[model samples]
Target chain A: MRATLMPVRIADDLYEFSVKDPPEARALAKALGDHPLALEVVAGLDRVAVQFAAKDETEVSRWLNQVAAPEVTHEDAADPIEIHVKYGGDTGPDFEAVCAALSLTRAELIELHTSLVHRVEMIGFTPGFAYISGLPDDIEIPRLDQPRTRVPAGSIGLSAAYTGIYALAGPGGWPLIGRTDAKLFDAARDPAFLLTPGATLRFHER
Target chain B: MLHILTPGLQTSLQGTPRTGYRAFGIPYAGPADEVSMALANRLVGNAPTATCLEITYGGFEAELEATCTLAITGAVGEILLNGTPVHAHQTLHGRAGDKLTLSPPQFGARAYLAIASGFQAQSHFGSTSTYLPAQLGGHEGRALRTGDRLTALSTGQATATLSTPEDLIPVFSDAFALRTCESAETHLLAPRSRDQLFNTNFVAGRQATRMGIELTGPPLEISGDGLMKSAPVFPGTIQCPQSGIPIALSCDAQTTGGYPRIASIARCDRHQLGQIRPGNSVLLLRRTPDEAVREGLEKQTLLKKWLGSALP
Candidate 1:
């Protein structure tokens, strides 16, 4: 555990706290995440970026040291939310290329991918785009060398072990293994983003 | 409300940034040049957070439906009211049915047009700023297009004229310098790469946008292992990808990134950042974090003194 508190003042209103430990950092993240004064809790790998309003830094700093960090369950050990996907067609143009790169048949690929559940590490890039952790080692791959100018929304993409869905299609480089019809973000929905950090996710072939 | 005759470059409605929701991957969309936007809003008796049109590289035309007090700020563009020359940095009285056009394309990028009492818009996640990627807020969640009409909160009764204080006016230049503090991972860079960041007069590339600005010069070669674990990144962070090209994250940048950040531009210079055009060359002047913060506070105090109070 990081005994002392050392926060890097990134900007006039932005401060980043490094806890070194992921869970403890997440604990601090969750503890003050939606706190009225903190404003936004932007969590990084092992740090929580507290962006406060101008002139509120002193008060926010005081709120930081005394706050209790609640225990947050790891996504890997949490209950899984099933995601239905369509592999290897218009929805997933890079499916064959991915399988060929990994030396796995379509069935083998599907079996390996669906077997171990993934965890939502963080939400980033675009609105509602969650970075999923824990892909099977055998199926791990890098992002495409040439990014597609326009990727379809709902595209399931992978770069290294991290898999995520492009909630709203735009420019993307992650190799698409498949696509899901599941809505990750919708303005009309009560909570716009369907996936939150530390949530478990499972893939089911449709 | 004003009717858009032509959207010109990329005109969108932006106000104060949508802060606090970055954890959900929401980009903090707002006016690129915040200081200029605030000044424009204040000139017309509206709060700086009021909704305003963000015009890019000039080429915009609009006709007013009602008379309103308006001020245009940021970038240098020729403003014409019904084919007559009008100047920026001063409040202009717009009569109903009058036409306002920003033309001739300024050397700088982005301009803010704020009307008195502000334009009314729905706030999504606590901001009216337009972020098109998610189609979230602002006028239909996208750039203001041709034939689109926007109504002011209240208008047709002109307010008293106000001109910017002579010393408070911004100076536009094609070349400038930004003071920056080296990042935590600065030691990871090759000594030459570190030197290039501060010494090189890097030119802003054509790929500049509200999301980020690409600076092209000598490729800032790095000898690090490879890609890094994704980490939190701020608007003024200057990150270098595998390509060695440095990218300055702006208002609409993602909350986090995987590339190695070389230096963070001082918060004081970000308002200047919005005015830097594609061809503009900039030097990343080095500064300590404490120095950066102190300079910013000083500037803020000066601005408040000139504006007669705290900035909106």
Candidate 2:
């Protein structure tokens, strides 16, 4: 896999390097051991955001130069976990709205949503929240002009070419179109989060 | 032995935030002002991340169930122990059953009340810091209320007189300088707007919350009209929505936003903005990532030095 590193400064001592994709990011993360800087691999469909702490600008530039083209081991991608969802209606108030905008029926929407295989881009916003990419073009929908004051936890929504499931209930503006009952986040759990960057997911209509 | 006579406004138990929970959208909410909180904690011989009362705009009055060493930091407010004048930011030894009353703040917002051994609260996600939105962490996941009796841990050490005076307490002001770096959307704005952001002074809007602080100033115009894709956001990100006004994301801010971010405040200076109340004037200055990191490290080093010197 070809990898390109782009050095971006977050702060005086905090710097981030955007690797072109996951294979390169995984490789670089392994090569750097016990570096004082905190390493974060921001998951994306085709790219990853590699962030680290820097002592200074000079150190950041030097580290970027030294770590370019680091060796990495490639492993077989994990099997996509199938998540069940109840789409469109009271549980998914925005479901019909989304279908109407796309001029598709409820069944058609469900088929399109379920057919595409998605990769976990990044988990953020709240605990266990997953940003899954790889949606079909016809289903892409824009976010609501006015965000909902309260979106129930586990409410799945599609907005602006991306889809994600909420881990916790909070004020969200995303156009939610479905709900999932699976417990994606539990502090009491050993793993804490069920989804991580690079995890693949497939949706099944419950 | 603080007895809650009235919880007035919002009060909660907080400490250093839980780590490794960022992936779950949980922020390390600990104290808004780490320096002040640390100083208060040190004054009473409590752990640096020990639970303490984070009182906002004070009017909280509690009867002291027992004598203990206490220190108040952040906003400048009238503090009275047993209806007598008490200094802030210095250790005070109160008699058992003394009633401590804190009047509304005259300047600044949020105050830290630290006692020896710290206040005891249930730990959630490895922290006592309360994230109100999730209804998790802190004392029962809610703000302190009247008639709430908070238990304090035993220090087993005698209270010592504080050498620092009340007037010398560290007080953050409204006219604070905020450090910023070019954001991902920086290129999206007019080239001239880049220079204008620093030159323009933005006033804090009344709609400030833990999630974000809205700035009211010269409206910033974006060069591009097309909507940008959503991206991960952190505290200090300055996002410009269609409103033309810029909003600075804070601790309780959303992890991702679609608005064009003109700049991001450095991590260290984020706290300075966090502590500012409504109507506070903020001056934004552009700094290289290197400068921001150096300043942050320097601040951290100074805090460590202060902690070392204060501890017995």
Candidate 3:
């Protein structure tokens, strides 16, 4: 843990705490997230931002002063959410391109993809778009040279070290390998997002 | 009900920002110009958070189907009631069948229209503001189209005529010097590039929208490889990409970004960002965080004094 965590005021209603460690930053976000004044708590790669209705740094500062760095371990994870995917067809438009680029057969690619457990690193881009991390270094893929103006919702995309779901149909550049039926985001749902930061999951071929 | 005779470019409903959901990749989508929205609402005797129409580049026309009072604000040029010229920033009474038309703005890019009781809209995440990309909030989660009808939330009863004081009206111009403060990655910019950012005026590129405005100027050089972990970005955040041009995030911008954040427009000056038109000249004026806070509070105090409890 760092010697001290200081919150930097970025805007009138926004304050950012720069913590280099991702897990600690997420832990810090979890600690201060429930503050009454905190409208939103977002944990990013190396920082966490707390948003409030107005400028209230004194209360946030007091809350931060009292927070002890909490340990984050896999043992603390809840039951993994299972997502079944339909791989390699029209739903997976870039499957052939990925197979050609990685020099793997269709069956081999699916085996590599389904074997490992993925962790939700962060959520961004669009509502409920979870950036699932833990892609093996060897299988890391590049984003498309030209982004599609609209990638259908529930489309599963892989790029660099993360796998993402197109929770809502919009523009995207990721290479899609499969599609899922699960609704990642529905404003009508009680908890809109299916996956949140730090959640773990595994994919299975349908 | 208001009958849409002609929908201007990207006219849609906006209300108080959709807060408390940024972590889900949702943005605080609301009126781009919060000050203008408040002024318009006040003239119509509605609360500051009441829903209003956000018209981009003006060119709007509508017919009132019920007796109501209306107020227009923001970057506006010519306004006509029943084809006779009318003024902006003041309350105007309209009877059934009266026509209201707004010409393209003379300077800025957006205008706001508010009714006495506010417009009825589909609310999402506790806001009526439209988030176009997500197809959420506002009317049918889309921009207004010709022939579409908008209903008032309740029957409007006109209050005493009110006009915004001359001193309180905001000026829209082609050139703006926005007050800004350093962000998470400000130090990463090279010394020469950092100086150039604050000293030079940038021309707004063609890609201007509620999401962000692309700016073109001398390429700002970064000292390092410029790769950083993806991080949270808010409205008014200035991000520098590999191409060196900066993009200023606005109200409808995504919750997170991967580009290097060089600076952020001070809260006091961010409302003006909504008025920025394509090809407008913009300069980032640096200030300390303490100075930014003071300026923001002072502006809020002024608005509160004028609008009373209506200023949120």
**In terms of TM-score, which candidate is stronger, 1 or 3?**
1
Q: Give the candidate number with the greatest DockQ.
A: 1
**Lowest lDDT 10-residue stretch of candidate 2 chain B:** B303-312
Candidate 2 lands at a TM-score of: 0.85
User: Chain B TM-score for each model?
Assistant: 0.96, 0.91, 0.98
lDDT of 3: 0.83
lDDT per residue (tens digit) for residues B1-312 in model 1: 699999887888888788777877888888888888888987898776788988988889999887788999888578999999999999999887999999845467888899998887767988999998887778989888899999887755567798888888888878878889887556667889888888999999877888777889988777855355566777888877767788898888777776777788887787777888888998888988767777877788888875656642
lDDT of each structure? 0.79, 0.71, 0.83
Worst 10 residues of 1 chain B by lDDT: B222-231
- Best TM-score goes to which candidate? 1
> What ranking of all candidate models by lDDT puts the best one first?
3, 1, 2
Q: Summarize candidate 2's per-residue lDDT along A79-131 as a digit string, tens digits.
A: 88888999987779888888898898999989988998887766677667787
Clashes of each: 4, 10, 0
Residue ranges of candidate 2 with Cα displaced over 4 Å? A1-4, A21-34, A39-61, A69-82, A89-93, A137-140, A144-149, A204-206, B124-126, B163-168, B172-175, B225-232, B253-258, B293-305, B309-312
What docking tier does model 3 reach? acceptable
Write model 3 residue lDDT over A1-206, tens digit each, in one string.
53556677766566788775667767777777887878788877678887664356567667755555555655358888899999979999998988898898999889888898888888886788888876775565766644465789999988766788888887666889899999998877888788988898999999
Name the weakest run of 10 consecutive residues (lDDT summed) in model 3 chain B. Answer: B222-231
- What value does the lDDT take at residue B213 in candidate 3? 84
Query: Residue by residue across B135-254, what tens digits does model 2's lDDT show?
Result: 567778788888888878774457776644444356676676788888666877777767778888788887677677788788777775525555556667888765567888776666
The better-scoring model by TM-score among 1 and 2 is: 1
